[model samples]
Target: MKVCELERSLFESFPKVDAESWDHVGLSVGDPDSTVGRVLVALDATADMVRRAHDGGANVLLAHHPVYIAAPDAFVPRSGSHPQAAAAVFEAARLGVS
Candidate 1:
């Protein structure tokens, strides 16, 4: 099956494993519009994940965790960055494109 299809199917099959009642988890990105030349599998999404995806020649990221939740106001990103920016920063860039 295609990657997106696989992602959705996998998420559906084991939603709780990838996430908990208080956690975020699911396919964050990977639209059909995406070229998807490469994929970066990560534990979390961060600016560093973006850089890692780019460096590893991955244009797409297949994160095990999900994005967007009910209480986002409490977990804001570092500026326009993603919530995982604090951890992604370990390998992310200052531009915060992630």
Candidate 2:
């Protein structure tokens, strides 16, 4: 299946998540939206990733790195604990993370 270019763009917009300085957001497989039939969201979408998407009938995986570097203290609306905390407040309105 053909993954959408738009979905790849979403990955590009993300800030460097890894703080170890030795790893990258590795994707050894296909593109982001490879004809996705479902989606999963998690701190590091693993089995939990598939579970979320699988149960929801989605094939997409949306994961946030646990060690993913974030600038919660920065001016940018960072995808850090602050945003995560805020999201926990309202499951209906999830904001964008960069």
Candidate 3:
């Protein structure tokens, strides 16, 4: 399934509007046009989790909590801030996971 299609499906069941105003829900990383054959769901998208998802052959990752949370710089590993989360984000992007 395509990433956009998967987003739509997830919203149908758990609408983004349903999420708390402070919550960031939906695809965190990856291209919308990308295709996914398998998905990995987790509460947090930690560096370890990202590696596991890639190693396990999961093309998409459905996370309950937002990794950025209004902090865009947190996803940059080279920034030396939020390294673990950044590692996860970078790894996920490298693996083409959403």
Give the winner by lDDT.
Answer: 3
RMSD values for the candidates in order, in angstroms, are 5.7, 11.8, 2.0
Q: How many steric overlaps are in each model, in order?
A: 4, 9, 0
TM for every model, in the order presented, reads 0.51, 0.42, 0.85
Deviation (Å) of 61 in candidate 2: 0.9
With candidate 2 superimposed using the best TM-score fit, by how many Å does residue 25's alpha carbon deviate from the native?
Answer: 0.7
Indicate whether candidate 2 or candidate 3 has the larger TM-score.
3
RMSD of 3: 2.0
Candidate 3 per-residue lDDT over residues 3-84, each given as its tens digit: 9998999899888888889886777788999888788889888767877888899888888777666745556543555656
RMSD in angstroms between candidate 1 and the native structure over all alpha carbons: 5.7
**Candidate 1, residue 76: how far the Cα is off, in Å:** 10
Instruction: Please identify model 2 stretches exceeding 4 Å from their true place.
Output: 1-7, 15-20, 26-33, 66-98
> Can you list the residue pairs that collide in candidate 3?
none
Task: Please list the C-alpha lDDT of all candidates, in the order they appear.
Answer: 0.54, 0.42, 0.79
Can you tell me which runs of candidate 3 are displaced by over 4 Å? 78-80
